[model samples]
Target: MKNTLPVTRYYGSKRKIINQIWEFIESENLEFDSTLDIFGGTGTFSYKAKIEGKEAHYSDIFKFNTLIGKALIQNNTHKITDAELNFVLTKDDNFNYKFFIKEIFSDIYYLEHENELIDIMVQNINRLKNYYSKYIAYYALFQTCLIKRPFNTFHRKNLNLRTNDVERQFGNKVTWEKSIEDLFRKFCIEANSYIFNNNRKNTATKSSALSCTKTADLIYIDPPYVSEKGSHVDYHSRYHFLEALVNYETFKDYVNFEKLNHEVKLGKTLEFESKTSISNDISSLIQKYNNKIIVFSYRNKGIPSIKELKNIFIENNMCCRICLIKTHSYALNKSNKALGEYLFIAKPKK
Candidate 1:
């Protein structure tokens, strides 16, 4: 069966291992009435829990990602209406749409015309009064932006990589060439299809893992991974453009002017991205949710090695089990060697 979940090309997305994660949950017979996906990057896991008849509470530090969770996970019966879709697609000649994208983003990330289209569409989306409709529109727009990018990431200032005439070993040129309107509509349809109530109230909150007060029967932690080889995945830096888009009103202030792509500078750093702070960060999380059945998703090659994580659980007086799920390699991890997905399941001793 095709995975119809609301997903984007997020770097650490669990879309591929979702079934395996679910299978693990099933095999353990871990019955839970509710689940909290603390670092809900793409909300794939929370959406899966909702589909499986669990009250899903999703939280993310990024506003853009939280909007996605709100649209797909928390939203029970709301979908973008035909009228709203028409409003977003239709351009009003009389209305003076803001030229933020056309002026600042010209020749940087997208073509001049494409940037103008984004400005216009974003303006139209803001005119929406219904919160759910607005979120769904933004979700579609986010996915549209990802599909058009060369590597589905805004990590580098490389518009030339997509536009230049050169033989490429990777990327879909046709998909990149598609109009933003077409891609927006395509994702809108996909997002709409994933909207339904599982008879449980779901929630999406804007919070950091350390600050989130919500508790659940089960907690899934998919913190940003730091590779043992000293590579770090900073999601805020990778998707800063989308982060800027969601916070367009105050976005100009956050722009890192030194950068060529006009990437947003997230004022704060996450400990999870730092080698020195990772173990402490993971330890803090384990201590916080020590009472719940804590499940962590980690890569075999990640820092705070599998053995280290097991020791952390053991130190917390919890019984831990490690399950390895074989999966495809990520673009970031360019090692030709194989990689394994690790799930660390820890239950507090009674």
Candidate 2:
């Protein structure tokens, strides 16, 4: 009934190439009430699967990504809109128009500088009914703002805005007013898919792929393939701001980060085990679901080495097969390359 939603950019967002990743499922004669997304890095796989007709059951260890799953997959709603953004921008227009520039700062940082705008937003939206769209829009803007922040990449919490004159000259960047964009338009069109919001059964608490073990249909696995460069790609920090988006309610009591946090790091926490370990477990699970075909799309970094995977899945039983290939991205970052991402099509070896 609605367009598909992209998985929010949780750290490990395979969003870079999930389109290529999902063609395997699309070609198959999938039969099942639900699709499971384990290691729900960005929930991209889950969202796509859900949009296509299968009941999507997604999970992630990150408190942030799971909320993304809910926002994008489970409860599709426009948290913002064109009209509301126009209004917010218009109201702030009288100001020097230099205040809304996109500079990086903490939740408290915005409260300190843009307190007036934030206050007005709360007041106006509170007065309106069915303001969910506007509320979401506010978040979308807020989330967008995080990216332009200096410390946003590693998400370590640092005051990275430029100096006074520098900020004065560019303060407008950090304080840019909320505006409607293409995704916002899509948000309007796609928000209709969520007909319900029951966080209990339909949702998976961990990776959606692993938690969804009950079904007897095609099971797809796209575990985190540790990149080929032998280095880890901490997806968590890459999209750390997602935590704020989902838990904005908790941020209402926002405090300043000028003194609290000011440095970001690549040593972010890992939410789950390595891909090989996970695939080993997934391989076993596929054996149990003998009646259904098991499909997997693994890249060089997220899951198994092709040789390791071939040994595991082939020995287990998948007889009939369809293969799709990926050559990796043009990105110089091995983390960006996606070699070996293919759908391992098979019915259990028995």
Candidate 3:
């Protein structure tokens, strides 16, 4: 098994603290051999579970994220070969590549030439025959798009942040200016290092956590963080560009052109429900998998506070244990103070 996961700057990704989370899971003495990561946002936690020789199942509502899970967790043996990488990176004349990314997304994210490259790359990725190969290519392409952006997000149309002549105080300009080919190749190589068989039929699915049908020895729930201050992370808005790439065939139909950012309106998922409803969402999810060991990861500051969550476990007749680990705020946040990362391990009371 590989010793490292591909680096990702995905918002709310647990890549940085997956070890801490896993250690806490271990200390709970939870006898779990298989894990279902329902909200598997970077798939790092599921990948870690796979690394630990468990059957790791990853699921997410967004197609792009599901691609990430498919590439890393589900795909145990497939790695991007040198020939595959060259095929995806190189532009082919036979394939009629559409310039939708360039025409529709011009002046929104990357430079004109960079946008053209994305058009070529995504088209080539879509053309790949193997499921794992296609997902891996998409993974590399998504990473390239993310790394080129100013905030590593598609939240705004701020191409000038990387293009305009301004004194850079923050953000890595060198990384931003890296060519699409170089970044795509680098990320694909990094992704290749993460593929290995753990001798299990691991899988990835695109589904809402509440409605996910897969059950395992342990159910890992790390829903989108909703702050008590009424602020929330809407991943669809932040990473719509990458999401569109996965659904590129129907991309034109879903484009919400009214928004300045031209974000694809994929509609509000359960994760983006109001702060009040999240508690019920949590309650319903836990009840759905109450028979299995349920491990919930959350921030102490979020809505449905740690106390509220524990109450849900009690109401469901499940004994629970909460482990708190202090961690720094996300890189984009102004406040750098450490905050509590809560992991609640609960099982149906005997």
Candidate 4:
């Protein structure tokens, strides 16, 4: 079966192993008619559930990710029309397009002209009438931004890697040099193609997992990765540009002028991101949904070890099973040959 879901080069996205994960879930015969993907990065896992005719609810802390969830999962039948595509692609003088990206981000992420194009597109997309239309446009824009970046992340200021004439052992030089306008148009079409009706009412939310009161039959928890060395992957710092795009109006207020890369500074830190608190956080989360089935995606050697995770479920009065995907390798961390992907499937004791 052809998976019609449009995949992005998202860090820690499960698009590569989604089918395998689904196969495992199906093989176990775990019963669930609805799913709540708490982290919902790239929404591929939830999309897989949606395609299987389950009611999918996608949630994330970042507004940009929620927009992606809206465009792909919640949006049943909306597709970007050619006229609407052209509207976002073309600049309208009446729209009062600001140069937030162009002025502040010059010599940072993209070429000057490309940054200006991004500024224009963001303004135009905001003027779109339909809610899903705005989200679909932003989805395409985010994909274009990600594809053009060196590491597919805005964590570093590395435009020199694209512009400098040097022998490159890594990176897609051609894709980096491609026109942002063309890339935007291409992704817009790709996002549109992924839209279809699954005959279920799916929803997307931008809220912390701890704050989510809505319960589902199955809760899929794929929290941010915390390494064995206590270092955590800060998605906020990595994708601050996309976050700013979604919250364009008030983004300047949250900008940290101290950072070289101009990362957005949020007020508080999440407990799950801390090495000391991650174990407790996971335990608390599992306890919160103690009565529901949960599939927790994690790495073998993460902050809270697989043994600790198994114990967490057991402590919550749930029967847990650990499944290992030993062949899996991370895209960015290829040097770590010892790492393996894991899933802890837990259901409350009857």
Candidate 5:
């Protein structure tokens, strides 16, 4: 199958293992009329499900990711038209655009000129008439921001890494120096290529995994990874700029002024990111979706051990199986030994 899904540089994305996941689903006969991707990061899994002719539902707490889901998964017929793209590229003189990114984000993430361009492009995107068109534009903008940043993350204020004349062993200075207008147009074309109709009504929601009231025949869970050493992968901190971009109306309130990078002080906490609470969180999810087949993706080095997770499945009266995939070293900690990617498949006892 052609991997037509838009590529995302999101950490812990399942893009590489999606084919293996499909193999597991087929081998286990876990085919379903409908499927839900709870953590829907990058919406790759949901997009894969849609490609397979299933009713796909995607949910994420982050507005940026949910917008990706809306653009690629939920939105079937709507696409960015040539005229719409032309409009997004054009600046309107009538409407006064907000300079929030330019004013507050100076010297933090992008060059001064790049920041100004983002401010202008986002304002143009807001003027789009169709909701899907807006999402498509946002999707492009988000990808463009990520591509220009070092490590493709906003974990630190490292604009100097891109601009400084220091000898750099790493980093793509050329891509970073590329004009935001050009990058935006490039990503818009990439995003436009992924939009299509699967004939079923797929939906995307912005909500926590446990809060989603929707049920499906299959539930795919790929929660945030917390290391056994107590380190947590906080998506909010890594992609706060994207969050700020989408929530520009209230961005200032969420930003942690005390921090150099201005990472968002998130209002809500994810239990899955806390080692003490992760086991319970996984158990709750299993119990809540007990009627549906559960497919979970985890790393060998994650906080909750494989044995504990399997016991949780058994305790929930479900038959469990595991598949191990040897993968490259994690991007965040390349020095660490390579880890196995584990996929836990569970189904109610017959």
Candidate 6:
């Protein structure tokens, strides 16, 4: 079974051990009525919640993630007809969907003649939308497709999903167009029944993970383990679209990228940039909500000792229990492991 939402090249996506995640949640017998993934990367937790029939809430500081979340979790699913495809892809008929290509490829000026090729891709995607959901179907191949651009992220950015660009990349005299196309077709055939077939839920915007404040029976947090490390998440650079999403309409202050610099200046954003501090705020939240179970995912990287967490929880009338999760080795050095993730389960006494 092709998981409609198979793992892609996400850096910290939980898709790696979704089963393990499910085990933790199910084993704890967490209330299925409400759940939250404050550090929703791939949003596997929230995604899983929706799949399992839970009222789920997820938030991330990244807008790129939010865009994907909106499309995958929020948007009302549309059957995606062949007519839309015809409108988007085939220019021969009345509808010339060239603008669609322009929107996504507005930044693709460097590659030689790549702009023209993007137009072709736009057409192809439009025509193909009928075969699958526009969100998952189009990008299944395009997003991960080997395109031989400068960064070499794809190994080859020129080739897209089909047609031919093998010559443009490594000059390999191989025609992978057919092979990739076949895989895409197969993926779409199976993906159609899984994700696209299901009704999507609503995803809110400009909200923090704890913003849903109406205490869930359980709350899961995987905030950045350190204050200095959050800098690694230059969300504006990584997910610039988020700046556009928030309507700080009156506030010219850049809310995404430029805002990071501001956060640095204001000290609201940290040099390292995790939201673990939200846990401290939970001490405040406990005044209103009662009998809350909290689970937090943490790594040894600069985390306060478990004692610190214990103190925080205790002060808030919660009991904190820590469980060892996994230790991952560095990619370059298999024997080296500087950190491991810890699961902190806290039950509120208040």
Best by lDDT: 4
Model 5 agreement with the true structure over 1-350: per-residue lDDT tens digits: 33586788888787777888888888987658999999998898899999999999999887888898999999987878878877877777887888889888889998887788788888788888999999999999998999999889998998888878888888787888787778888888888888888899999989888788877899999988888874565887888889888887788787777889877765347657777898899899999998789989988767778888889999998998899866654554456665778988888998
| Residues 1-350 of candidate 1: C-alpha lDDT, one tens digit per residue | 22467655888788877989989988888878999999998999999999888899999888999999999999998999878988998889999777777776778788888898888888899889999999999999999998888778887778898899999987888999999989998888888998998888899998888889988999999998788885564888788888878777678777776878877875346657788898998999999999899989988777798889899999888897899887766554446465678898889998
The TM-score of candidate 2 is 0.59
Off by over 4 Å in 3: 270-272, 334-338
lDDT of 6 by residue, 184-294 (tens): 454444333444323434452334444544345566666554433444443333323223222122122433223322221111243224455544554444433336677
Global lDDT of model 1: 0.85
Q: Lowest summed-lDDT stretch of 10 residues in model 2?
A: 97-106
Cα-based lDDT at residue 12, candidate 2 = 35
True lDDT of residue 329, candidate 1: 60
When 2 and 4 are scored with TM-score, the better candidate is 4
Candidate 4 residue-wise lDDT at 7? 74
User: Taking the candidates one at a time, how many backbone clashes does each contain?
Assistant: 0, 39, 0, 0, 0, 14
- The candidate, 2 or 6, that scores higher on lDDT is 2
Worst 10 residues of 3 by lDDT: 330-339
Tens-digit lDDT track for model 3 on 119-234?
88888887788889998988888888888888889978899888888899877899997888998999898888888999999999999887788889999998887888855657
Q: Estimate each model's TM-score.
A: 0.95, 0.59, 0.96, 0.97, 0.95, 0.60
Q: Model 2, 252: alpha-carbon shift in Å?
A: 13
Local error of candidate 1 at 290, Å? 0.2
Tens digits of per-residue lDDT for model 2, 1-350: 54444423233346667666566556765556676666665566776666666677776655555555565656543454456654543354343432211233434234344534444443443334554554444344444444334433434443435323353433345333333333333444444344333232355344334344445355656555465456564554445444433333443233223534322222234323454355567566566555566666655544556666677766666665647565554222445543554667767555
Residue 19 in model 6: lDDT: 57
The deviation in Å at residue 16 for candidate 6 is 1.5
Output the number of the TM-score-best candidate. 4
